[model samples]
Target chain A: MSLIGLISFIGTIIIFLLSKKVYKKMNWIILSPLLICPLIIIAILLITHTSYSDYNSGATWLSKLLGPATVAFAVPIYKNFPLLKKHAKAIGLSLVTGSAVAIISSFLFAMWIGLSNDMVNSLVPRSITTPIAMDISEIIGGEPTMTAVFVIVTGLTGSIIGPLVIKYIRIRTSAAKGLLLGMGAHGCGTSKAFEIGELEGTYSSLAMIVAALISIVLSDTFFPVLQHYLVG
Target chain B: MYMKIIKIILQIIFLYGILLLGDGIARLVHLPIPGSIIGLVLLFTALQLHIVKLEWVDLGAGLLTGELLLFFVPSAVGVVQYDQILGVIGVKLVAVIVLSTIVVMACTGLVADSVQKRGAKKA
Candidate 1:
């Protein structure tokens, strides 16, 4: 790689590590590495007059690792299969409903605000985890990078308001709470679930996996039809 | 220590192999879904069927997922390019995402909670 590429790559890792430290010390969701690390990297690139292509030459290497990491998701899903089976009905029905609502509501909201089809497609996958969400965005003719931004912003929003929703709604069941966070926010929500309890965390993660799978299946089927009618 | 490192590397390679297998299958079948997702399902099924043991991939998988966010940085940072698109409607877009998040949380939590409560009562 070129020296510029190397700088971008190394700079990302260093900033990520430091940002993780800051998040730990502050425990503030706003300071999350997912939110700030990119902000810092983008600022550096702009200030240095470095084009994204130059930075990406090296950073793309890290992004490629996401493919294998996506496969790696199976380990946790497999480990938690028993739990998934145990609460099959509740998880199944709710995730089906939740995933449907996620897509439908995103489309409605995006359309209500007069966003184009592309932005709606991107926003539809905003509720899922990043890698899968990005994949879905590409599949449906949305900009994956824009979807990534929407996904992170969605994560931050959901995690921030998730606790307040739980409190005001008087949700007492850990399973319900976990499903709410995971289905609503994905990874950040799962982390928030952990802070509440282990069971909440476990269920939250399970919700993310199942919700993602369901959303994928929906993307191939329901999503296109929705787009045809709504955006067409 | 050396063995541990070797094991991790080998497991990662194994995972990569599975990812490639997924890509091959997706191409062959012309599936609409992404191959990594196909690989995820395949791996999960293999574990369930005892065709692939969990220990073989556990450490490497853990390592990858643990740093998953790092993998997303390049793509997310690419958002900088879309500044012009986001500049005008950014505020409205953020509001939509926030409002939708609240709606999603409410619907999911309420539905799940009621279903769970009914299940508990029936038991």
Candidate 2:
């Protein structure tokens, strides 16, 4: 690899690790490693006038790891199977409903604001985890990079507001609390769920995985029909 | 310690093999879904059937999933390429996501809670 590649590669890891420590110490939403690390990297690339391709030359390998990570999702989903089995009724209904609501509402809002068809497609899967969302984006002809941004923003916003919504609504059950965070924000929501309680965290992670599956099915079967009606 | 490291490496390789198989199936069949997702389903099914033990893949899968954020950081930063889109409608786009997130959170929580309450009442 070129010196630039090595620098970008090592720099990304160092920044990410440092930001993780800062986030741990600060425990602030704005300081989240996901949001902060990327922001800092982007700023550095911009200020130094380095092109994205140069940075990505080394970073693409890291990005490709997402494929294996996607398969790895099965582990958590499998481990959490018992939780799904326990709250089978509540989880099944709520997540299906939540996933539907997430996709439909995102489409409607995007259309109402007059986003392009491709942009609408990207927004539809923004509520799911990044890997699956990007995959769904590509399958549906959306821009995967744009979809990633939307997913991250959704996660950040969802985690920030998820707890407040739970508190205000007086959502009592750990199952409901978990599903809300997981379905609403994906990974970030699951972490926040952990802060609230252990059971909430388990349920949240289960909800996140199940919600991704639900959204995938919905995107394949339901979203196209909705798009035809609204955009056509 | 060396044995543990080797075990994880081997398990990861096994998982990667499933991923390859899934990609092959998707290409052969021309499935609309992505291969990784298909791999996820395939792995989940294997684990459920006890064909692939959870203990076998658990540690390796856990490591990959735990670092999921790092894997995507490059792609997320690729957004810098879309400065034109972000310049024009970034605020509106953020608005849409924030609004939709709030709606989904409230709706999911309320619906799930109410359903659980009804079930509790009946029982």
In model 2, the runs with Cα more than 4 Å from the true position are A130-145, A191-202, A224-232, B1-7
TM-score of chain B of each: 0.87, 0.84
The positional error of residue A110 in candidate 1, measured at the CA in angstroms, is 1.9
In model 2 chain B, the worst 10-residue window by lDDT is B63-72
List model 1 lDDT by residue over B13-55, tens digit each: 9999999999999989987566887888899899999999988
RMSD in order of candidates: 3.0, 2.9
Best by lDDT: 1
Q: How far does residue B115 in candidate 1 sit from its true spot (Å)?
A: 1.8
Q: Model 2: clashing residue pairs?
A: none
Evaluated at residue A59, the lDDT of candidate 2 is 83
Error of 2 at A170 (Å): 3.2
Model 1 deviation from the true structure expressed as Cα RMSD, one decimal place: 3.0
TM-scores for all predictions: 0.86, 0.86
**Which clashing pairs does model 1 show?**
none
